[model samples]
Target: MLFLTIYPKLHVVFALVSTHMADEDATTTKLRDRSHIDNTLRLTTAEPTPEFSAALKKLQNIYHSAIKPLETAYKYNELRTHEVTDGEITSKPMVLFLGPWSVGKSSMINYLLGIHDTPQQLYTGAEPTTSEYTVVMHGEKSRTVEGIVMAADNSRSFSPLEKFGQGFLERLVGIEMPHKLLERVTLVDTPGIIENRKQQERGYPYSEVCQWFIDRADLIFLMFDPTKLDVGGELATLFKQMKGRESQIRIILNKADNLATQDLMRVYGALFWSMAPLINATEPPRVYVSSFWPSEYAADTNRQLFIQEEVSLLEDLNQVIENQLENKIAFIRQHAIRVRIHALLVDRYLHTYHEKLGWFSDPHEVFEDIVSDPDKFYIFKSILAKTNVSKFDLPDKEAYQDFFGINPPSGFKQLSSHCSWTSGCLIDNIEKVISVELPALLSSLGKKETPPPAKATPAPPPPLPETKPKNRWRKD
Candidate 1:
């Protein structure tokens, strides 16, 4: 009996040891992979155009000096920080290709990269071939990297995807190619949407991952072929999520050369009819019909259609680089609006708290009383503590002091001046940065005029003096 117990315990210990060894090995591999990816990113990152570089710098300055300070003050740091980083505005435009498996997504990519004559840079087949999301970017030499490397590269923007679970981590692939086209655009090819119930049960957060990409992609190509014209299941869900991004989405009807004119029209009609409800748009998305690569079965008429469609798609993609600054400005403007609203609420709270305490009646007397006995202001602190500010939207208390021009009381003069200055400066900064300057910059870049910002109402006039006698008990 003693021997049996000892043997089982020994076995358990050995199993634990083996698992630890495996974990260590995995960690070591991930570190090595991360180093390799970082080096590759350094080599592949292209220099931004002068116009884009200048715009990015101006935006970064505004973010760090104005927006970031306000957000840090109100504790709203979590709001849209991912969209603009020091380097994000200058990074290359991302183009994402989303579609069902074997819909010629990869083949079209190969053709664009001029790798069609060489061994396929991306795996293509009639059945599902790509089992991972592949990100192809410019490099001096061709290389393949794993997802961990992407997470490790701080210069790249994919770190957020790491939270999608290990399944997603395991299924991400990064391809570095020397194609000239990649210098202007970063292309992402996702694993075709899985329709099988059993496959979907594998716990990959497909829709969530796709939504992340959609949020960052400057242009999204939703590819379809004759074989899979109807969108359903996960694909339909993905389309529904893309409702507001219609301007960024382009529907590509691929492999049209395989059908005759009559058959092609039927397929086109079928696709449009089926996708109408799924897209849920005022007008149908632009559908670019093309046979991206030469097909042995393609007819002369099909070839003509492919040429026209391919030219249009390429032209649209080329315009993305020029529009990068415009996109960044738009992103910043949206976030700025949110910050302004948050500041407004914080200012309102401060104003109300002061009014309730009757501090506005005789500011000098109130300041003297509070300074003489700091403990007497416990109600003010308590009110702030009890306020139901959302954790995500909370502003910094110190920021409120700065906005209101309240310096820590060195003497009586500073204390008395508190609440004397209105929050007009904060409001003015928001309007100037987001409304006036941003719109002017956009127009200078020859981009369309952004809608004018809603005019901010000035802070309510300070409360009128009360004739009632003061309550002395509240004052220490």
Candidate 2:
């Protein structure tokens, strides 16, 4: 300690345990202790000279000797066990209704679905509302609740997951008929990520939970009561993690029924500009304040007039919804393209795995490892450019015959034979998407649909270099 203190140049070491590390036997224990000591030494010791650094490196080897039997592990498990994803799973994309508590996440959900139903047997007001992560799936088969359930609404501790249930919120409802807008997507009603003393006590910000959803979400409508929008820090994290992460995560400046029009414009302008940097927008950030609230005291004295404003706002809302829908479809299409590219990628480098790679675990584990590597996308992009694929545009239908098989089923053959078909589909889903599904969705977000961009044909590649006889090939 004294040597470290006296010589600013010295390198010293120390060790600390990682509660998250999975392999902690005598070997892992020793390695972690060594890591702490090494970091301590690096912090101390007489100014780290080339010789001291080498000595420190040797000490690390001794500390982790126990892991030698596990030939594949490089170090701790936290760095290794976590999943990195570049594609969607079978799960439907999540649509979260997020905001500070009492800003009406539940009410908005009800309004969006146009329902008055709540949990069963409990008075509508008594049942838990949006106190946990409530997932709504269809309920055509002898369901209990007409559509909503508030049976369980509690926070789950997250230092590590508690026994699946003890502290977590549970979903109690099966969705019935829904607001037309929800027809194509799964709706996730997240427990308020703020002011739940129980959640914050568990050592994670509610914001992180919200972020996890945004990270996977194909469409996100982030609600905000203008009053709390100024709250800082977490918004930055939210923006950093989600800004343009998906084009559909739009800010729903909710309860616009609260602000004066002139004041609303002034404040919203400032707030939008402030958050603009967090989103990947070349234009200023876009937001829609809803005077959708029936009351008058809040902002947007114009909301009660939603009836009067219906014709105009409806037209406007349709355009917005279309834009958001386009973004959502585009995000999913891009994800599909990535999976195709990754399939091509693994095929190109299958030899690196050990000779006896287990069919069940090896493919997934290797896929996880490769995707987690930060450079994975860069490599994937290079491969995609070579393969002639684009996330925004599907490859030509001809590209799929060898992929899907030279002889597909009759149904698929019909699809493939379309002169304009691509990747086994009738046509690129997104192009038709703009004219169909997107109009309603973007209308909800206040974006107008411009005509889709005209498709272009690629020019043929330059003729290949002419070959010459080897004996006479030299240029004069």
- Find the candidate with the highest lDDT and give its number: 1
What ranges in model 1 sit over 4 Å off?
Answer: 1-49, 75-83, 117-120, 196-202, 294-301, 342-428, 447-476
* lDDT of candidates 1 onward, in order: 0.64, 0.40
lDDT of 2 at 86: 17
Q: Please write out the lDDT profile of model 1 over residues 300-370, one tens digit for every residue.
A: 56554455456556656655655777787887777776676655544444444455457356665554454
TM, every model: 0.65, 0.45
Error at 31, model 2, angstroms = 66
The residue-level lDDT of candidate 1 at 276 comes to 83
| Superposed Cα deviation of residue 168, candidate 2 (Å) | 5.9
Candidate 2 structure quality by residue, lDDT tens digits, 1-476? 78667864443222112311211221123110112211211212213234333433332232222112111121111111112221222233456666555455665555444342344111112112455565553334323331122222121111121122333423223343432333334566665545424544534345555555676565566667664565466556666767555454556666565567777677677777677666676654335566333122323266333332322222333333333334444443343344334333333223223322466665546634443452443444554565446554433223332322332121122212323423222223323333443343334333333333424332332222243212111112
Q: Which residue pairs clash within candidate 1?
A: 73-395, 73-396, 74-394, 74-395, 74-396, 75-394, 75-395
lDDT, candidate 2, at 465: 29
